[model samples]
Target: MPSKIQKLEPDRTTIAIGLEGSANKLGVGIIRHHPRPDKSSPKPPAEILANIRHTYITPPGEGFLPRDTAKHHRSFVVKLVRQALKQSGVSIADIDCVCFTQGPGMGAPLQSVAIAARTISLMWDKPLVGVNHCVGHIEMGREITGATNPVVLYVSGGNTQVIAYSHQRYRIFGETLDIAVGNCLDRFARTLHIPNDPSPGYNIEQLARKGKHYVELPYTVKGMDVSMSGILAYIDGVANDIFGGKPKYTDDGAEITREDLCFSLQETIFAMLVEITERAMAHVGSQQVLIVGGVGCNERLQQMMGMMARDRGGAVYATDERFCIDNGIMIAHAGLLAYETGYRTELEDSVCTQRFRTDEVFLAWRDD
Candidate 1:
């Protein structure tokens, strides 16, 4: 042979997928990166084989009941999973692991994703990995912003916590003792007679900007834990006064309107998060703060955190909606780290749990 050119193998490969189906949304994601393909092959250029994330929103309206949402999740999983894999340009046989969120969600919905992943893993002869939903949020925050050991303020429909990572676990320095932040926002929006369509929260956020007064809302915080249910009751009382032939909103068309209520609600909730997070920073003795979760996507909340960060000489990092909200990428990214760390779940693993602690996952299983 006069000359021979060696063919090079790709340095990167995708070995895992992260699936999140906690509620009304189903996130399917595939993460890929390059390293030495095998011991015989030298590491090539750093590359991302594929990092794909897709979301399937539950089609039903705001008051999406659990049963219907679960049904939606089941129906959409087949399509979304296929789409994610296809978009990633990864064949089913190439996936080394299938990771799915295991619990802390509606049982029917959680089981739907778990069963789907199980079916795929069994068919493809790959290992199954179950992740924690909350930890997924945290890790996604880290991956997006490159923040490590920052105080975490996670606010969402089901969770509101000021957290710190310590001893291989996320510690809850503070958390919601009552109704979640997003739930309060939605319920308050309903009381304002706002349309449930097109996302009541965004609509409320729009209307809130038009508001210019502080209508007092209760602030409940006890040793880093807060309650919002009573605030809802009290706000409902105010709104009922306006509706019960009193004097507000309905009296003069748009004057003194729902916008005021929305603005006040946002201010109240955002302030609570800021206060608790600030307190946690002091408690943890760390100046860096990372804000993650759906509620963290709120502009007003970001502004509030920004203010606190300035006060403490600390920087606050927030994920764009891409990673902030429940999405497949976060799950995939988190799951990849878990899988690489050798965390795998057996098919016999349980499907449903009411409250699964995030730190309890022994293998990093990647928070679902």
Candidate 2:
């Protein structure tokens, strides 16, 4: 870590442009951080000039593939960047740095966006900042909700973790041992042949709302970690049985429907998540909890988490879809924070990986 911090004059503002294509969604964002009025004053909220995203949707029952997603990103990255700059009313010269997701995602999509970031960095002669995808979600959640040092529960298609900031790092207290919760839900939706438009998880949530009976499913919680693969497999078998003309009944002898299965799966998995998150909060002696990542946009999860937080005499913080889902603004915000601390990714070191851990990032901007 560099000992020198980048300081700005009171009248100066820091600007950054970020690109994100870690999965199916390709996004571009521009943001500005105004200088603080004084050293003792609180940091002002970030001003989002433009936050644009375009997701590559597959047909029903299909998930996004790395190559296809990368192709989609290459097709739209430049356009989105131009639109973001136009919407923000800022020129390339005004941007202090270019940020992009560095890792913990699909290889092709990460590389596609990285190439764009590097091009922008060279074309505009701005510094490059490589941001961890998970860190982007955490910092964006904190900024949007104004939650100061709360326990973070990051849930997405590829990740599920309970994290807390400590010793200049976001340490993981718990995580999924198998597939992530969102992955389970998404795969279950595919099993049901549900539409992927607007997200399969959202469709499942809608179906779950109409379910009157809850079928039993596996609940796997091991110590501080949770497992969803068993539950997914079991539920998938049940769904297949129903589709194969084998009638499945609930405890009340009512025949199980797809909606009922969706309901049961969601309830069981969310309960497991709540249990572990509560345990983490208890261990850390923190009442406040912040939920981030794409799955954090689920209203049912938010409601369940909120209920658990209230029971602990605390509160739950979550953002809407725009910020909750993967977006470039988060990359810009987190990278700019690092850039303000004299952090930069040299051209030779500007590489993206497929398996970057959240704790690998050193939080130079944070003291706690």
Candidate 3:
């Protein structure tokens, strides 16, 4: 932790509106941060005035495209924004700043949401705060679960990383060298013809619950990082073989089912995650583990993480879909924290990107 830099005065409250549409979901959220009465303490508990989202679901055997996703965001963002403001009962003038995710997502969707956010900031005369998508998830997880200084396992459709804080930065201890864990699941779900109603991963989790056989799949963990491309390719090939009536079976001569495939994939990938997260925790000398991002909502992953943490005599912290999934509230929550440290994204510099790493942002509000 670095020396505290004075930004906000004591006992003052700041309200922010956040916009998020990095991928298939477009979210609008309102958040209020109240400075602690005692300046020595950290920021007080944040209030989530309103957090609303609308998702764009594609048909089975297909993944969402950047172009189509952006169109969906453009269509629904304004409606969600209006609903969020009305639900929060906060007037536009009450908002202190407008926050939006600036990077680490699909280019088209990010740009669409960025345009919306810039419009809002200009219209409301509020300052803009460009937030990193991964940091948003991490900070919101810490705030919601009160897990300070825990090792973070950020898993999502486009990212997989093990993170920990050191020297005023959220350092990445490990990450995926290939496809993300969620991407593997989503693609596999498509191969199985699973519906993408709520989410492909959620549907796979449900199917995995009915699975009894543990079909062996390649479990590849390279040191602190994991690679899912090979696993996905192997599973897809097996699924194709099964679909072609080519008879695939386990080593014990038992036939494989779609349920078994999902079960094996989940168990194998989650174990690799737990292994790497545990390794990072041990390296950092911390026991607490916090899981965030879209894939963190899986109950089985939570259970596996809890077991790993319990074995180390620590605990696992997590949030439900509202905070776990890509949403505006986390962006608002994290951007508010940065804004408290006098961080601002000038209108001219409020550009969105597709490759913002977690360690790029400097943690100015932290004194730990």
Candidate 4:
């Protein structure tokens, strides 16, 4: 496609521009990876040249559809790319590769962004690197938190998994048997008619903070896997009943409020996550736990995870919204790593899929 893959010189800095529109959010980011003087040394830190995103939000009690989300991404991707390049202060010619999310997302949204990436790759004469969405989260989390090797709990809207690195792959130790954790929260938020302005999950977290009671919900954890669909269905019914003026109360005779439902749901789901994550850590014989993805931004989840890791005499690592939420920077960082290892995705093979799994990606940049 391009002339020839550029060699990553040890003394040179590699720059990549990444585009991400896997879901409702469209993002563009530029990142710089400075190489170590000694090639045998461990990798150095990455520099975030520019990180920008625009979200497509629906009204209260609604979810974003694939068609609308794709339109939103198409509308903003080019503008975001331009802004990212300008903010990075880097010329297009200086970019080594154009990276984009290739899978594990809504088909239309992923295709919309991939088309933009393909167009840029051809226009700028740069190679293209297709990144796995889940792998992008893991790589960016490791870079931001410096968690060398940790049992990763990846919680997002479309996916939920507990992972560990092994044999040049991110192996999924356990995952949701039903809907994802974030999806459960989002659906519950819709049941409550909460605003999806910032995020339904964030609003739910805020409401949960004011809760003084806990209404027990189904705890579905079978072996290492967890289930949230039943819980969501159960809670949805409870929420509807409460809204319909049905009497519901806690064990202490206190009437359960909306805030209490949010609180109880958060606690129950987070506990299931903690249980699986701890089990994964034990299975891998590692104490470190790293949380990534959009729902990983939940402070309650982080606190609970931290408590679990501490109980095992280890530490938990998590990032704020910037790195935790889906963004182009993570795609850029992870893609650049693969690019440096001589991985490339030709134009024809750069097609995006909606069902890519985390374990499907080969971690060529990491040792066995």
TM-score of each: 0.86, 0.97, 0.97, 0.98
Clashing pairs in 3: none
Please list the residue runs of candidate 4 whose C-alpha ends up more than 4 Å from where it truly belongs after superposition: 1-7
lDDT of each: 0.73, 0.92, 0.92, 0.93
**In model 3, which regions exceed 4 Å deviation?**
1-6
lDDT for each residue of candidate 3 in 53-150, tens digit (9 for 90 to 100): 99999999999999999999999988999999999999998898899999989999999999999999999898889999999999999999999899
Instruction: State the displacement of the C-alpha of residue 360, model 2, in Å, after optimal TM-score superposition.
Output: 0.8
- Over the stretch 56-126, how does candidate 1's per-residue lDDT look in tens digits? 33333346677777787777887787788777788877776787887666677788878888888888887
Write model 4 residue lDDT over 295-343, tens digit each, in one string: 9999999999999899999999999999899999999999999899778
The CA-based lDDT of model 2 is what?
Answer: 0.92
The residue pairs in collision within model 4 are none
Compute the lDDT of residue 40 as modeled in candidate 4.
Answer: 82
lDDT of 3: 0.92
Of the candidates numbered 1 and 4, which has the greater lDDT value? 4
